[model samples]
Target: MTQQTLIRAAVVALLVPTFALTACSKSNQDQAQNAQAQLQQANKNLEQAQQNLAEAKQQAAEAKAAQEKQAAQKKVTEAEKDKAEAKQKQSEAKQASEQKTRQARSEARNQAKSESKPVCSDCGTISSITPIQRNAQHGSGVGAVAGGVAGGAIGSQIGHGAGKTIAEIAGALGGAYAGNVAEKHIRKVTVYRINVAMDAGGTRTVTLNSADGISTGTRVRVEGNNLAPLH
Candidate 1:
């Protein structure tokens, strides 16, 4: 080959390598761009997945909160119902206690009345004495006789018959006066009065006949025309 031919051939060889290297670099650059794009897409997918997961978690939390709220409401309702029932029971118990107390009072009053007979208040005894003044006359006469007899018997033991007779006369006169006064005083009946307090804050005055052995604070029953005195 000539010198000119050899130089042209050598130039062509160097240009071919340069063209090939340029083509290869261009191909590599395209590949790198594609990989970057794929990486960007993957990152976007990951972000989307994370967002979906957060949304699901939020939904679950809301559902749990709602369920807890419902459970708490149910418990409150049950507690309220229990409180109401307890209140009702307490009311019933109070009513029953009141009723029992009333019944006991009534029974006690009745029992007391049944045991004692009717009596009066003034003399502390019951007397069917007629013509109340006659009681005094009769008692005076009996006392006089008794006094005279006792006096005469004592005088006879200490003096003569005439002195004894005079003493009997004096004794009888004094005895009659005392007996008449006693009989007058004993003829009257006793009277019992009580003030009763009612449940409604009211008070009642109860009057009944008083008798012997009957005392204050005694339970008694007043019947028709007869007052039963209690011991």
Candidate 2:
């Protein structure tokens, strides 16, 4: 309780003695009655203050409980979001795998049909084989053009007058040849270029990425652009 409440209690305690002394004198009966009334009012104010404190504690408890509940709900919501993302990723991976399988089978069938035979899922057998370098960028003549330009620039820097013109022409020719060679060296990959004789008596040319024990007369299967040795 407050200091005012404690002081009121002290004053009431003293009033009993005070009243007795004044009653003995019997000269101030009305003043003693006034003290008693004030003591009662102070006691009432103390009780009201106590009641207000109890209500405030209850409200604080309720607020804390509500905050905890909201945090729990938020955790649950975040967990659900994470679960949904994982499920979506798994579904995408499954679809991609299935699509890749279908494409591989379709490509194999097309390769089989290249032999003028009925389209099938496999690509026949190896009849004749050659080890060849395949350059991804060489067939378009872009290399030659770039090479010629670079060669002419170099040639123009070298000699003077008529000799410079001859040098440019010679450099261009040389550069074109070098560029073609450089492209083959830079972009070429080694593979066994094989002619496959289909079981259906039609021949198809196939490029296998590696020899991998495959040779002339070796039977093989084409799954998409990949080759597998026949068992």
Winning model by TM-score: 1
Candidate 1, position 227, lDDT = 47
Can you write out model 1's per-residue Cα lDDT over 1-231, one digit (the tens) per residue? 999999999999999999999999999999999999999999999999999999999999999999999999999999999999999999999999999999999999999988867543321223221221223224545555655566555555654688766766666666566656666666654454544333234434555443455444544444444445546
Instruction: Provide the lDDT at 224 for model 1.
Output: 40
Best-matching candidate per lDDT: 2
lDDT of each: 0.66, 0.80
> Candidate 2, after superposition: displacement of residue 178 in Å?
92
Record all residue pairs in model 2 with backbone atoms less than 3 Å apart, i.e. clashing: none
Off by over 4 Å in 1: 1-9, 119-231
**Count of backbone collisions in candidate 2:** 0
TM-score for each predicted model, relative to the true structure: 0.45, 0.35
**Candidate 2, position 76, lDDT:** 94
